[model samples]
Target: MRGRFSQAWSDVLRGSAFPHEGQAFLEQVFSADVFRPRPDHGGREERFALTYERLRHINDRVREAGSTVPLVQDRERLFPLLAWSAVADPALFYAMFLHHCMTTGAVLEFGAGREDLADVLEELAATERVGALLMTELGHGNSNASVRTVAEYDADREEFVLRTPEPAAVKFPPAVAAEGVPRLAVVLAQLVVDGAECGEFCFLVPLRDADGPLPGVGVRPLQPSPWLPLDGAVVSFDGVRIPYRFWLRDNAVLTADGGFTDPFGSPAIRARRTLSLIRFAWEAAVVGLAATAGASAAVAVRHAHRRRTGGRFAAGRPVIRYRNQQRALFGALSGAYVARLVAAATAGPEAPALTPRSVRTTFLMKVVTDRIAERVSARARTASGALGFLAANRFLDYQGFAHSLNAAAADNQMLLLDGAQALLAGTAYTPPADEAPAAGDRDLLDPATWETLAAVRERILHQELADGLRKATGSGLAPFDAWNGLYDLAERLAETHAARLVLGTVREAVREVAGSDPVTGPEAAGILRDLLALHALEELAGHDGWYLAEGLLDADEVRGIPALLDRLCERLEPYAEELAEALGVPYPLVGAPIAGEDYVGGLAGTAPSSGTA
Candidate 1:
């Protein structure tokens, strides 16, 4: 049984040397003492306290291993833990990412050569102080280039005075002081020297200590975020002085004569390099969202398998016997697998340099995964009925994460539009190779056929968008006006491109898994093939109209998708339990009573301890 799915899936999901170690760490720290199910009802402060404790407990255990953070030092191990964390709690996941990936990652990457920064990193690693990265401001949310917060060089004092020039300049959503833990942030502010703007740069600044907010720093709590709760707040600075040594520079120096010398020729490039740590944040979001999506589907499937109901045709039959339940639950499960596969390939340990192309790739991968998570979680929640609505069931946790990730790094829609504009303007985009119309003649169940159709659609859409823009611009329409004329198609093109990219990633993984594991190789290969087929069909089903319009498919083919989906769902029903258990979400983390053998008995807190099967 273990060889069937859990072991095979675990081998594929973890791309690092720390698979067993990661699982051990989760089991050790997530014992009853450190980990607890979220309360059915709790106040904001109460919930915030739980999130804080969760962060501290995990960091404490990691410190016990070594002085330097292992995962941060070698991020190959980060995604596995992030996925597990997301299955547990979205808020906990948020805090963990900010501390380990955002704050600690930035320091490790750029805070070299500074003894003060080293001390701060040590404290952060030891969980003595919390960490955050503040780049977005209330005034210019998501527009980092136009941040109004300024750090003016005080040459006489050999320091920088960091100040939020106005109310709008206040940093929003840092969760800085409410935890009552010592906190530090890597802040992005415009550098000003002698009344001249010197591009955006990062600085290490202390935001709070055990006592309270640091002097010259003001913190105000914002309303708790819906579904996903954290101690988020808006922070302002009043002449907060930062020592010259605190500046995070990448071989950039301040000359004694008050001149700045940077090896990177341009400030824009320097700024991009400064915020490159954001890639880790994106990776974290992908892994976490993938895990949550999978876990949600798992719980929903388990419930559907056990849940019995009466209908006009049958009495006391398992809900999984019904067509509606199978479609909702199995489809979600298939999507979950697709999401996990995509994350495994895209969010690898190796970090790519930040560029327009890489940024777009990361953004679109995140967007695609985010959409999958949202859809899977919503279907899971609905499939479970009233039981799913209960906080103790854990479906809501995935729902919250899915919704939050859509806007977490930046709003997905805005990013999609921005990415579309870049692609339209030829920002290093490589469209999928155009395929011949005959490519569509292959069986719909063939992954190759899905890949071909998706690629052809993307290529056609890109060409149409480019030609439309050119024709409109040549007709004397403003660039924005011309682009606006095809806004719907532009967005569709972006989505199709993202879907193709994810499909390409899934295909690669399937090929690798087919040849890699000898023990359960055939079984694993069979499972992946089925999942890949279902995922591909799901992606193409939505654009059936477009596919028919473009002659990629005939009316009969398009009309057959519904029945095809139902058949796929029925085929996957037997393996649903194995798939859910193989996701590696600990039973305790799910905390769903209905998922247990005896739902009624388990409701009294008699569920088995949290651990993998």
Candidate 2:
């Protein structure tokens, strides 16, 4: 049981040395008493205090360890721990909040040509200062281009006066709030120079010092949210003044004569460029959601292996052996794999920067991962029965994470629609000449077959969408009304495109494993291939109607997907533990006592139960 798993685990460890080291360090620190939350606390305030203290200790330890601060220098190592931290305590995970600051600062230095701010960024990173991004407002939400917060330039004073003109202009959802911990913030405000609205830009404003809020800054903590443990609040500026040099003039510049000049012709273009800082949040969200899905699946699978139900068998079989159980739990396991692989591919070092293509990719991947994590968490919860509802299992926490992720960075629906618009405006898909195996003629397990099926499905969805839009417009409907009428179709197009992308990614991963060292490669590839098949088949099973309507599959072939999924599940059952372990989910992060090997005995507080047979 351990041979293939051990080999694959070793391969992962060897492939990324930093994550191994980082995991070790995290396990050590997380084991400390100071890091644990006091769940028995009677009130929300007490719980919040304990959580806050634990977070502070963790931050102190991170600083002491000299890990990547402000900006991630080595994501391969730090990302794993970040993922684990998100699972363990999402509140503590919020403490590592310098990435956007670093990104905004970098954009200013490179894109805005504010080269002089480079040293400031380095100092912020080195000092490990907590930096908040104040962009989202009560009125605008994620529509940063229309924010009412203004940063008007003062020529003689050579400073920018930040003001929230109305109640709606107050920046909400800032993690710092009244905590007074975040000493600085990259405030996104409309750049007004000489009475001209130049557009949105980032300015490094001192939010607080050791003594507390700056002269004209007010931080009012928002009503507590039951889901996210982090403190969030509305930050209002009452004529807060900062030096002109604090402006992150990435695509725009302030002239000496109190004039603004930008390469982009319009304020809207510059505002869009400035809002690209959200990419960091999107990447972090992808990694965090993948980890959440992996951990949820691990807990569900472990519980399934331990829990038993009596039936026609002599004693009883593990719940995982049940077809329904396998369908619910194993499907989630496949989703976890898909999310992790897609996140890894999207967030790699060489990934493109802040372009329209990169932004769309990030948005699509983030939405996909969030949706997968949510579905997997729900399935995991259902599979675990009563055990999943217990606080000790952290299923509820995982559920909260799913909701928070969907709402974080930007609303998931909004992001999906944004991606849809980009897709529609770009090139239309050209369907291949029936590359997929006809009905019963293809090998369901073949990677090529799965790739072709996914690609063809995506193409079909795209073509159908294009035809629908053309017809809608041709019928004399306004463009916006036509799009609004086809909102559901647009969403389906985005989902289909995402599905195709993830399937392609998994196919490549399987091929890589197969082509590696002959010793472990074959075993790893075989297991991954089954997972890939299950993923593809499950998807096809869900969308069988679409396939049938598009003439991509016959009724018999569509009906066969369920049986194929069951066969795949059975072949992979013996290696379920190994598959979950390969996801690199730390054992302690499982956060459920039922995941233990002797959960049956432990639950009874006695000898092992014969039912576990």
| RMSD in order of candidates | 2.4, 3.7
Residue-wise lDDT of candidate 2 within 241-271, one digit each (tens)? 9887787776566777787779988888887
Worst 10 residues of 1 by lDDT: 604-613
Q: Name the candidate that leads on lDDT.
A: 1
lDDT, candidate 1, residue 404?
A: 77
Assess each prediction's global lDDT (C-alpha) against the native: 0.78, 0.72
Q: Give the range of the ten consecutive residues with the poorest summed lDDT in model 2.
A: 9-18
